[model samples]
Target chain A: MRIIVPIKQVPETTNVKMDPVTGTMVREGVEAIINPLDLYAIEAAAQLKEKFGSKIVTISMGPAKAEEALREAIAMGCDEAILLTDKAFAGADTWATSYTLAQAIRRIGEFDLILCGERATDGDTGQVGPGIAAWLDLPFATYVSKIESIQDGEIIVERMVENGYEMLSMPMPCLLTVVKEINYPRLPSLKGKIAAKQKQVAYWGTAEIGAQPNNIGLKGSPTRVVKIATPQVARFGKIVQPKDEHELNRALDELIDMLKQKAIL
Target chain B: MEYKGVWILGEQDEGRIKLVTLELLKRGRALADKRNVPLTAILLGEKIDAESLKKLGHYGADQVIVVEHPVLRYYLPEPYLNVCKVLIEKHHPEIMIASATTTGRSLMPALAVKCATGLTADCTELDIEEETGNLIQTRPAIGGNILATIKTPVHRPQMATVRPHSNKPLEPDPQRQAQIIYEKVDENLLGSRVKRIGFKANPAETASIQEADVVVAGGKGFKKAENFKMVHQLANLLNGAVGASRDAVDLGWAPYAAQVGLSGKTVSPKFYLAIGISGSVQHLAGIKTAEMIAAINNDPEAQIFQVTDFGIVADLFEVAPLLIEKLRNHLPDKEA
Candidate 1:
């Protein structure tokens, strides 16, 4: 089996600052790291390679710095990597973004599976994975937590739904967006690190991937942001901590009193 | 079709309407009424009852567009998207709101891409701009670190997936009337690339967390997976549903259904007990509607304490057992 894992580079900051006027992320000098969820995708692919003698390939679409994420995936056990970077790829919505990835996958030739994180933390849209599946015309599943079984021509997996988990069986040449619960990622090996440094990532752009000019990036994206601003937190509760054992008991008594006054207990 | 009315995606489970669908309708009603446009509800399923259609009318839908077919019995992303594409193209609704449940979370994005429109996911707040008549979608970004308000100026139908429990459902009024419009699904277009193997539901209504009036949640402070048993024991004692933070869910301490966060479930219980959750902003966003919040954690600086009405600084391993014992004593009739 052969697999393609899509990874994304996001800002390391949890409180990512946004441009107050434009409503876009202020990405001038923020340090970037692989999206936390994509690690699970890489780990899932690596485990398959170890168990089934499959080859692992990772693809990332971003600025030049995104190659760092691809190399990190390689270090974690992928066989090859592709970096889809170009100025035209900037400001791409999930539609144009997934379309670009679909074109890249077509360029990469045949693969049994394409893996992606359930969503990206930065954009936080789970759209691209399914969008890619739509464009490539493949069976796809999202928020998958476990691969119950996998073999020639088919795979059965557990996907998280609204109420409970659903066991799904689908044929190969399918795309899966894995959840973080799928597996714990392994640290890069010494040999893997050296190999990752030496491996060259195939860089593909709009022209190389045969992506249509009209459906490439900002030009292709239909959604335009009108504004962005910080939201107001509505709660006005008192936040406090007890000082000692005496205060602890007093606090508990006060809580019980409040609950009683409100007739909650 | 002038892209006028507000449309609510009516999501259902086993022929019953989901709460998120009702919540979306209420929000849709306000937006539609503000813009002085009729509100529409789109329903796709094999069978939909007249009572269900009436329910939509009572909830403020002026029209209900339904596409019933055998292939639409269960949700298949491809087929669902196709149905949405047909309705969206034909009606050209000015705004479409969907519940951020599993089905809508998947369906809306796919449909939005196909329609070349903008979709805001897991929105905590939604409104219409008075001047431009654009949709104002606000949601937490960066794993719920901060909330961001986004607007779509260039799109025809502004779409958003509202978090469940973020809005209250309007009281039903039998006097309200809505025209039920039936549509036929093209069987060929309804064919899905993904084949269903089977759908096995654990069947616990509270498992979704939306139905739980009281939720006992745990997080990374539990330290290990086995410690989650304490959290469940506490919930069981209180007769409340068990929930978890994303960390606990990802670490295998709790099932994904029990997760409470932006990417997970949004819950607003009457009483929420955070056993060990340190509280990420994403986790806090899910519980903002809880009438009262009580948190127990070892770290003093944990953000969970900020929103909690009652804060106890101690290890969950210790506090959980004590609370369970005290609660058990207080309510001897409490079910375990």
Candidate 2:
């Protein structure tokens, strides 16, 4: 069996900063980590590879620096890595993003399964995985919590839903977007790190993947960010101190009355 | 104005139509009415459930498109997207909308890519442009620290995914009527690699948060796992639901299903009480749409206060019991 995992590099939640002038994230100088959720996808892929004697290929579409994330995936036991990077890919939204990724996957040829995190930490849209599945015209399951079993032609997994979980079985060559509950990612070992350092990362651009110029970048993206600004903060409530038990009860009653007046009771 | 109609992506689960589908139909009808265009719904499944299709007319769909096949029973991205693509390609609707449920969220982005159009996810508000009749999508951005208004100025069909329950579904008129168009499923395009074996549902106790009306949410300030019971107790007293900040859930104080954040469930209810939460950007992204918010924390500068209608700068451990007692005394005998 052959498995492909898509990973992303995101700004550490704590260190993320917004530029006041552009209303965009300040990516420079910020620490980039393999999106925490994608680690679960990598782990799931690794587990499958270990069980089935499969080859694992990790892919990422981002700036050249994103190669670091692919390296991290390799260090976690992936067999190979690919990076889809180009100046033309800048400012692409999820739609354009999934299109580019689909083109890249087509170039990579055939695969038995594609795995990804439920959503990216930066965008939090959880669209790309399904978007890829849609473009490639494959079956997909999202918010997968556990893998029940895998047979020659079909795979069974548990999908997390609102009321409960549903176990779903889909055939090979399906795409899965996983949540954190799937498995804990393993830390890189010394031998794995050495292999990752020596491995060369494959690179692909828009021309190589046959994506239309208008469909691969900012020009291709339909949605535009008009303006970004800080949300206005509402005033804080004034604390009311009670002098005695009678005053305390009265204060509490007044607060409740106020809430009722607001129709929030 | 090449595009000129509204489309709703109808989602089905286990032979039943999802509530979000009805909600999207209601909203789609209003948009179509405002623009003086037809409101069409597209339903893809294994079999055409007549009972569910009939409800679409009541919910305000002017036209219903059904694509039924045995392979379409479970959500396969290939077949479902093919149906949507075929519908959009044939009719060229001006706008498309979908509910921001798990399935919709997963499918819409991919569909948008296939259509080569833009898609705004988790939008809290959707409106039509008076001049162009294009959809104006309003959604939280920068981790809920800012609300961004997005527009696809040059696109033929403006698309968006709305969070569930953000807007109430209109009352079923029963008087409304619509046309039903059945489309053939393309079996050749369907991938042979994937097949559904069986489904096992998750336990009920852990899954209740999705249907919760009044959710009592706690954050890192709750101190320890034992303190989470205060939130549970308050929820039980009010016959409500329990939620937790990403921090609390990450610390194992609550189940992952109870996590409320950008990466978790986007819930909007009549009443939401946040306890001991400082309100990180991700956490706020999830519940900022709640109609009424009450926050309790010892920190006077907590960010949760920004959107909260009422706030108390007191310890949650101290305030929770008192609040429960007061609610028990004042609330009506039956649950609202």
Candidate 3:
């Protein structure tokens, strides 16, 4: 029942603002926290570890600062942590990112399951998890809401679709991208926090993971951001203030007329 | 190895083409015309009827490629990935587009990784670069605070997924003719370790907010869960769908399926009504494509007011009941 959870450290994207003149993200003072969704992955792993009495290892690939997110995973009950940090890993897209993670997972050897958050907050693309599964050639499921059972050599789960929920069964040694509906993550325990403080996280670079020089960085990423722009926020801003009941009815009539003109009602 | 033609991975349900696929065909037709290449629709399913295949041509496809297999009857990543990889290799396409639905989101990324190509997710805009003939993909980033335009400089069949409802399908023309091709592959390519066991439909969901023409959303200012009834009432009156802000969903006042925001679901209904929502950027991200938006809140300077077409600075409690009563009385029963 050994499990692997991939986590990410992301800026509070809600707090990320755009400079009006430069049109670049103003990230100077924004605080970085664990991707809110990844906590669910860590929690799913922790719940399985408690039930099966097995180990849970958390992994992350980013700048050295990402180790703080790994340590937080330990505080939330992951047994160990690994940080894949290097200057070479910069500017990797989902493809290159997943390739490096697959190499790390190969180095970590065998595991029963790999769990990841549905998507990272910054990129908002739920591709890396499936990308990793493709690289590793493992069966995978996305937008999983519940894990119904884990029997001999197989696991059953429910995944979301357009209209309904589809129940699926996949062999062990598979991957899953979990949604927020999975479970409410538990807070870090005092004992777990003490252990996390003492746990020495292992940091690996491209060389240690035997990653191909061309496949671990900007050169390996097929997609490039050619331009970035702040979206213009424009509104009609028609306002109506009704001080009394009669005026309120008048306003309502006007609103209905607009709806009728738009053919929305 | 020259890449040519524009390919759209058409989605099918029970052997019928989905609306999203038709919408992609509309965009694909334009890009192909611009590039002077043929627009091809790739359909994979079991027992697809002839009429369904002909509809692809009517929409815009110059060629419709069909790969029928029982395993593909339902979407599992392994088999679909295998089939797509083989087809992509056999006939190199310059560009490929898919709808950012459950199937497309699941399959395209895995296929892109296998092919070692670039893929942009949930792109709102796509165009051909005049200089390099590259696909210019634009998508929102960091909760719609910014947009990033991406390109695949060295990859063949540059891939992207557009969210459903972001675009409309073109008018069908039955006079159009399309050449159809059927492909056969090895049985081993269809094997999969994952299996679908069952499907559970949500009967209580009368209308999906994603496909609804009108949406009535409520936020945290509603105070109590019971207050959501008014939101539902308004939606019911309009025969629309009810939506909830992230705050409302987090407070257990509404289901996550009804939640609209960066983390929830993106909706592009024709008309949207926001009540008590202060319009965080994340929530606004989901509804930015909505044709018209109207907001009601007690606060005069709420951020929602900045993006809405109509703004009412008043208490929602009084407004909701009054609006409901007025509509019920003034309109015919069926219309209301």
Compare the candidates by TM-score and give the number of the best one. 3
* CA lDDT scores, all candidates in order: 0.80, 0.79, 0.89
1 versus 3: better lDDT goes to: 3
- lDDT (tens digit, per residue) of candidate 2 on B1-336: 467789998888767887788889878987888899899998878776787788789899989988888777877556666777777888899899988877678778878877878899888778888996668888876566577788898876888999887876779888887788888756675553455555655454345565566788988888988878878777766567888888888899987888887766778876788998887656766787777777888787676776677777776766777776787788757332
- In model 3, the runs with Cα more than 4 Å from the true position are A15-29, B204-207
Off by over 4 Å in 1: A13-30, A232-236, A240-265, B203-206, B220-230, B246-252, B262-266, B285-291, B314-322, B329-332
Question: DockQ, per-model, please?
Answer: 0.42, 0.43, 0.68
As for candidate 1, its clashing pairs are none
Off by over 4 Å in 2: A14-30, A233-265, B12-17, B44-59, B66-74, B171-196, B200-211, B331-336
What is the i-RMS of every prediction? 4.0, 3.8, 2.1
Model 3 lDDT per residue over A163-200, tens place: 77889999989999998888999999998899899999
Per-residue alpha-carbon lDDT of model 1 for A189-233, expressed as tens digits? 998899899999999888899999888888877665555554433
Alpha carbon lDDT at A65, candidate 2: 93
TM-score of each predicted structure versus truth = 0.89, 0.87, 0.96
Q: Report the poorest 10 consecutive residues by lDDT, candidate 1 chain B.
A: B199-208
DockQ of candidate 1 (2 decimals): 0.42
